[model samples]
Target chain A: MEIRIENLTKAYGDFKAIDNMNLTIADGDLVGLLGPSGCGKSTTLFMLAGLNKPTAGRIFFGEHEVTDIAPEDRGIGLVFQNYALYPHMTVEDNIMFPLINRKVPKNEARDRAYEMAKMVQLEGLMKRKPKALSGGQQQRVAIARALVKKPEVLLLDEPLSNLDAKLRVETREEIRRIQQEVKITTIFVTHDQEEAMSISDKIAVMEKGVLQQYEVPQKMYLNPGNLFVATFLGTPQINVFDAEVHDGKIYCAGNMLRSGCMVPDGSYKGGIRPESFNVTLLPSAPDAIRAEASHVRMTGRELQIRFNLGANEFRLLVHSDMQIGVGTPFYLTTREKQILLFGQDGKTVGKF
Target chain B: MNRKAGNVIANILKYGVLIIGALFTLMPFLWMILSAMKTNAEIRAIPPVFFPSKFSLENFTTAWKAAPFGRYLVNTLIVTVFNTIGVLITTILAAFAFARLNFPGKKVLLTLLLATMMIPSEMLLITNFITMTKLKWIDTYQAMIVPWLASVFYIYLLTQFFAQIPDALYLAAKVDKCRDFKYLIKIMIPINKGPITTITILNVISNWNSFVWPLLVTNSREMRVLSYGLVQFQTEEGSAYELIMAASCILVIPIMIMYLFLRKYIIEGVTQSGIKG
Candidate 1:
């Protein structure tokens, strides 16, 4: 089912947790709501699940407005962060609870529960309670319970956050595979960019209860809508510098980096991704700025070098085959397309 | 070797104090049982006999034939069983509402309910009695069972337990389309078996031993509970200490047996609620 969230807002007294957020999730598409803590990603997921009521909004599940509907009637399965399996119940009974609540016959419910357990690879453990299961197994049981009723939309709230690092990766892949097999329109909330980027067909980046950008993962990473999106998406973070765009020339720290700029003459913020910087052995190269390598550390296949350009310090990742040492001077240059300029208001301006 | 000797001495001292305390508490019950087994003359002997000369069931037969003790036991069991069931129902529903539901004036309503706990139940006895009289329910089982069906302390205790359950569980049930009452019966009550068992045992014991309410409400012999029946037996067998002791033993044995069977759950429930007995 496709979901349309129109002008959704949730307010707690004077504070708004979600502010007029509008989004449309395509049918059978696995989207991710990505943001830091308290950014309202979870709140949006709850509203979508109908567990929370919006202050002013209309939510539609394929042409039917369900803003006032209860969670159970909304035809969406929600998996909580802690996988709230009934501790007193066995895996089979936990999966069968929803079916039984719908008044399905006992035999049919048991069959369906067994089928779901088999799908989650829990058939052999059907008689064991939740406390006896490992964290990953408990997570699978929660998913099986949620999907046993075949809800049209599946909502997961930090589903893999409780697992260890290795288990988190494995479980996310399992979740993606299951979501694909079920062909359900799924939206999962996560604070981990890599997890979101790895699984989601589209990622919606949010900040302070407002939607920042909604695009495919690579597009949002490469061509961010604004400064926050640029800095929030990447690991090691994008390097930002205070610069001036004067008379069609870009100057950073009293040094001219580029000319023939098209942006209006004023102050702007310049961002350069760490991997975008090019290193040279030559003392002087055209459009190459001189930088002194201050710190060099090997990180597996890449060398993370901290270099100083004038008084500014920036980190760069390079192939470890290059022999670079501390205090060595090198020429640094980047392609024009790699440079991102943001106006004073933090929105991307004209062209790089 | 010196440290081991010191530890042994400390252990002896700890158990020594505990043994003395246990003996002090058990002395009265021991006396009652011993007195009940003795002949009348042995009970009144100069230095009252610590042990019976020859144990016999003579006093028990006499006590059993004196009045309708069997009838009183039956009445007590009926009132206790019905009262426990009623209290459990009322307490669970009220506690679940207080712990989870959000409604207008919820805080004020809870404050009012809790304020009733501070009013001293003795003050409400006369009012409750008058209400019973007006309902024409005096000298009936309803008078004894209905008035004590809901207890604020139990409700508060269970509300604490219910509140400790994660809200995610409730939301999960809601998403499954389980109604509130079904969730309570299937999930909340089952998950909180220890506390609920404690409440049931406590309620059963309290109902079994209830004296004042039964005394005030019941005027007929057929409607009297065990506690009142024991008092009546005492007055009728005045100066016959052996018969009185025998009747007391009969009343006390059931409670002791019940405690022996359920002591583990009692301790678990008390510690879980963080409340002293």
Candidate 2:
């Protein structure tokens, strides 16, 4: 099912959780609602699901107008973050709930539930209650229950946040696989950038209930729309330094920095991902952006070298096992393609 | 030896205090039982008899024969069930509304609902009695049950439980189009078993013990409840003490059974709800 949400707004008295938001989700597209907590990604997803009544909006599923439709009639599957498994029921009963509610034959509902349980690798645990299962197992049961009705759209609200890190990765892959097999129009909400980037075909990044940027994950990572998106999308985060344009180059703390088209007109803040900076021995090239090595820590695969650059201690991720000492001056180079410059208002100024 | 002996004496004193407190609490019921067994003359003796010289079941027979107790037992049972069921239904609905839904007057309505709890039950008796009388519901079951159809304390209890439900569950239910009358039955009601059971047990016990309203409204002998019947038992012509003791025992038995079954829930409910953080 293709979902089109237009001018969706939800207000709680004076506070507007979602404000005139609009987005189109293609059929079979595994789109992600990506943002920090309370950014209205979940709110938008809820409004689309008809769980929340929009203060003002129109929603369409394919050609059908479902703006005011009841949630059960919308034929959407929802996987809650806490799973929301019917604690009173066994796994089989939980999965069979929607089917039974629809008044499907009892035997047929059991068959469908069994099939879904198997699909989610929860076949052997069908007789047990949710409280008896592990977190990952319970998550699988929740997924199976949601999908048992063969819903037209699947809405997942931070479904993997409760899992441990190793389990999160494992279960997310399972979720991705399930989505691929089902090919339903899916919207997964998460504040975790890595999780969204790894699974989603398209990501709708939001802030303060406003749609900041909606694009494919690769494009979003390679080219974020604003400082928030840029800083939010990267782990270890993007390094933002205040700088100004003078003599056709950006100058920072009495040192020259690389200038792309962003420097031509005026001053702007520059963001560089930690991995964007390459460090080498001082003797390799004397004229590089010079910094004093202050601290170094090994990260198994790479050395996270903390160095002082004009009273600011910035970090660089270099290949592991290069013997380096404190107070040793090193040359740091920024990747031209990786540099992101933003205006004072925090919107993307231009690429370097 | 000195310190150890002092510690032993302190432990004995603590136990002695607890046992005395327990005996103090239990003395009323024990005396009621003992008085029922004693003759009126024996009951008035300078030193009350703790145990009758000769046990008798005579008061049990007289209490039963007086005031149609069988009918009163049925009346009390019906009123308790109807009152509890009514309170449960209304409290769940009102609580769910306050916890989940947004309406124009919701906050004001909730404030008003909670405010009713502060008004003492005795203060409402005259007006409530007048209303029932005006409605021609005097001596009717509705008179006994309708006034208790909604309880503010029960609503507050269920509302606290309902509010604790994760938003994700509501969201999941909504996405599936479960937000109608169906939502109450499917999502909200089923997930709140703990509070519902706790409320049901509480309402049942209160309704069973309730005396004032039933006494005021139920003029017909058939409309009298167990508590009213107990009053009637006392006024029997030439009352026998042994029969009254047995009657008191009978009245106390059902309460004991209910408490036995719901003891944990009662304690948990009190601790969880009685204290405000």
Candidate 3:
């Protein structure tokens, strides 16, 4: 089912948790609500699940407004961050609970639960209680219980936050697999960019209760809507510098980095991704800024080199085979397309 | 080696104090049981005997025949069982509401309810008695069972336990289409087995030993409970200390047995609440 959230707002006294957020999730698409803590991503998920009421909004599940509907009637399956499995119930019973609540016959409910357990690879563990299961196993049980009812939409709230690093990766892949197999429209809330980017067909980046951008992971990474989206999406972070645009030229720290920039002449913020910086061992190169390497560390297949240009420090990712040393001077250059300029108000300027 | 010796000495001192305390508490019950097994002459001897000269079952037979002790036991069990069921129902509902539901003035309402705990229950006895009289419920089972159905302390205690359940579970239940009462029965009550068992045992014990209300309201022999029946037996068999001791043993033994069997749950309940709180 497609979901449309129209002008949703949730206010706690004077504070608005989600402020007039509008979004439309396509049918059977796995989207991610990505943001830092307290950015209202989880709040939006709860509202979608009908666990929370919006102060002013209309939520539609395929053109039927369900803003006032109760959570159980919303036809959604929500997995909590901690799994929230009933500790007193065995896995089979837990999965069968929703079916039984709907008054399905006992044998049918049991069969459906067994089928769900098998799908989640918990076939042999149905008799065990949640406390006896490992974190990953418990997570699978939660998913099985949520899916046994065959909900149209599946909502997950930081589902892998409780698992270890290796388990998180594995479980996310499992979740993606389940979502694909079920062909359900899934929207998972996550603060981890990699987790969101790895699984979501589309990512909605949020900040301070407002939607910043919504696009495919690659588009969101390569062409952010604003400064926040740029800095929030990438690891090691995008490097930002105070700059001025004059005579259709972009100048940073007294160097004319790019000319013929199609933006009005004024002060602007210049951003460059860490991997966008090109490093050269020679002391001189065309339009290359001189930088002194301050730190170098090998990270898997890439070498992370932190360098100093005048008074500012920056980092860049290069092939691990490069032999770079600390305190060594090098020339740094970046393509014009890699440079992102934001106006004084933080919105992206004209395209490169 | 010195630290180990100090630890051993501390252990001895701790257990020594505990043993003395246990004996002090057990001495009166031990005396009652010993006295019950003695002959009348032995019990009333010029110098009291710590142990019976020869144990006899004659006092028990006499005590059993003296009054309708069996009838009293039956009456007590009926009142206790009914009252415990009523208490469990009322307490669970009230505690769940207090712990989970949101409403205007919820805090104020709970505060007012808790404030009733400060008024000594003895102060309400007359009012309750008058209400019972007005309702024409005196000398009836409802007279005893209805008045004590809801307890503020038990409600507060179970509220604490219910509140410790994560809100996520409640939300999950809500999403699963489970109603509030069903969730309480299926999840909350079962999850809190220890605390519920503790309170049930405590309530059963309290109802078993209740004296003042039963004595006040019950004027007929057929309606009297065990505690009141024991008192009546004492007065009727005055100066027959052996038979009185035997009757006392009969009244107190069941509660002691119950406590002994279920003492683990009681301790677990207290510790769980203490640590969680």
Candidate 4:
């Protein structure tokens, strides 16, 4: 079930959909192909399923090369974005279609289909057509249909994107549970960063038909290789300010914050997570970002204060017990380890 | 109060036009039934009769005996049924290829197939007759049936509908190892029930009403369809208008029943196919 994609590329005339991609997904590993729309994530998934032929490269499932094989012969199961259930078929029939296609005995196929449906927890609605079921239910039917054949690798394209917010969370957790029980190597494609981070063992982040970074979720969050990866992963995104290192000191908002910076003497982008900032009444604290608070709002237990530093705006999370009025001058400090320093080329050159 | 009155007036105006249109359309049918039972004197009157003074079976008996109407019924049924089945087979195959498969000159070939529809069937009558003669298929069922086998219009209609099916479903079928022909029969045909039914009803109707090609190729009384036998209603002296009307009624009733049962499919298929075309 280990998939190895080497030097794969798919081009439409002169425009490449996937460009020289390389990755190795270990057996039983759940990998997420995460990217924005038209970023070639689906293209990579399709190539792995053998639904699309790579322009130049080879794909190996354990030992055999499946680059030129037919899709059915590739031992892969694929779920589409809209679920793609046959409208004419009841849930039972839809789930049983793959088994029947393999020429399994009629009753045996029925038993396996029922078993898979139950695994996906679609027990009572087997007689209803796709239109009769809810979006999450139809998606379950699609999953059952794909897995009834016991494919070595399961590929799902934006499987939970059609569900409501609450349903999406429940369905994703359900998918993770099912994938764990089956222990089949699976690739989940989505544009949502939180969903990818929550369920994936590892993520292969793509951009403009190229692989930007491939790493574990926690490592990718804390240590992004480039500005794009840092910005793409967190909500209320990582705030990046124009900064420079002068005389081995990091300077921002017309003040020196830290000394002995790792990056050389040059302009750089300094990224700080929203939760990494500290706010206080002290305006002259050392190694702090100086700003004037514009607004303060309470969200549950955390107090969020909006502040302006020069022309750019940023927000900080603080303890809700402390009362801070608007238009108050404050100093914000991000721990040195929490700062990400990027070079002129938009890539991290200094970790601290 | 004014709005309610305006609504009532608008409703009346709308239904008044619709009811008048329905009666106008039904008038010919009313006239045909009335004339079939009327005496010749009433039929030849300055104005047509609305209803006969006394209902009579005289015209039905006369029309039934004048020609082999029973034999013509059997012949027309055989030709229409076989023509419809054959045309469905050929057109579905051709349309599936045009819609799903990719090959060299596919666009040009489809454009040419569509272009052939503009050359009215009348222009091909002589050439087809020559072909029938060369094949020595004269006075045979093949001449009548084979000439209408491949229809460009039906192919285009089916292809347009088939193209609307999502490419993802086709890929899913491919992954399930369903071959092209199996996909057509099991997936495409079943899901596109509307268009297929539309094609079947239309094929039966057009073949049932066919006149020219059957006239050119079939001359014997045994080979003539219902339309050809209707010619027997006329002679060099004068045309028998009453018996022809009676025969017309007999000929149309079966097709009417068929349409009544299949009108839902016809409307659905026409509307679905009409979206793109």
* Best TM-score among the predictions, by candidate number: 4
**Across residues A168-241, which tens digit of lDDT does each residue of candidate 2 receive?**
99998998999999888899999999999999999999999889899999999889999999988977787777
User: How well is each residue in B1-277 modelled by candidate 2, as lDDT tens digits?
Assistant: 6999999999999999999999998998888877776766776677767777766766666677876777878898899888888898899888988998888998898898888888998999999999998999999999999988998988888899889888776666555445556777877787776568778877887888788989999887778888876665455376555556667777777878988988776767666666321
* Candidate 2 Cα lDDT to native: 0.82
Q: Candidate 3 residues A1-352, lDDT tens each?
A: 9999999999999999999999999999999999999999999999999988899989999978999999998899989999999999999999999999999999999999999998899989999999999999999999998999999999999998999999999999999999999999999999999999999999999999999999999999999999999999888999888878899888777777778877888888888888997778884567788877789988989989997554556789989887788887778878659889888789988545
Local accuracy of candidate 1 as per-residue lDDT tens digits, B1-277 = 6999999999999999999999998999899998989888998899777999898988988887887898899999999999999999999999999998888998898899899999988988999999999999999999999999999999999998999999999999999999788999999999999999889988988988889999999999899888875565456446678887898888888888988899898898878877654
Off by over 4 Å in 2: A5-22, A54-60, A63-65, A243-251, A257-265, A311-313, A343-352, B1-21, B131-142, B218-223, B232-243, B261-277
Listed per model, the TM-scores of chain A against the true chain A are 0.96, 0.95, 0.97, 0.96
TM-score for the A chain of candidate 2 = 0.95
Itemize residue pairs with steric clashes in candidate 3.
none
Interface RMSD, candidates in the order listed: 0.5, 2.2, 0.5, 0.9
Pick the DockQ winner.
3
Per-residue lDDT of A225-331 in model 4, one digit per residue for the tens?
Answer: 99999999997688888887888887776767578765679888988888887677785566666677799888878878888767657777888886776987777
Report every candidate's CA lDDT: 0.90, 0.82, 0.90, 0.88
List the DockQ of the predictions in order.
0.79, 0.45, 0.83, 0.65
Supply every candidate's count of residue pairs whose N, Cα or C atoms clash at under 3 angstroms.
Answer: 0, 11, 0, 0
lDDT of 2 at A123: 77
Residue B112, candidate 3: Cα error in Å is 2.0
Worst 10 residues of 3 chain A by lDDT: A306-315
Candidate 3 residue lDDT tens string, B1-277: 6999999999999999999999998999899999999987888898788999888888888988888999999999999999999999999999999999887998998899999999998988999999999999999989989999999989999999999999999999999999898999999999999988878987998999899998888888899998875665456446778887898888988887987888888789768766321
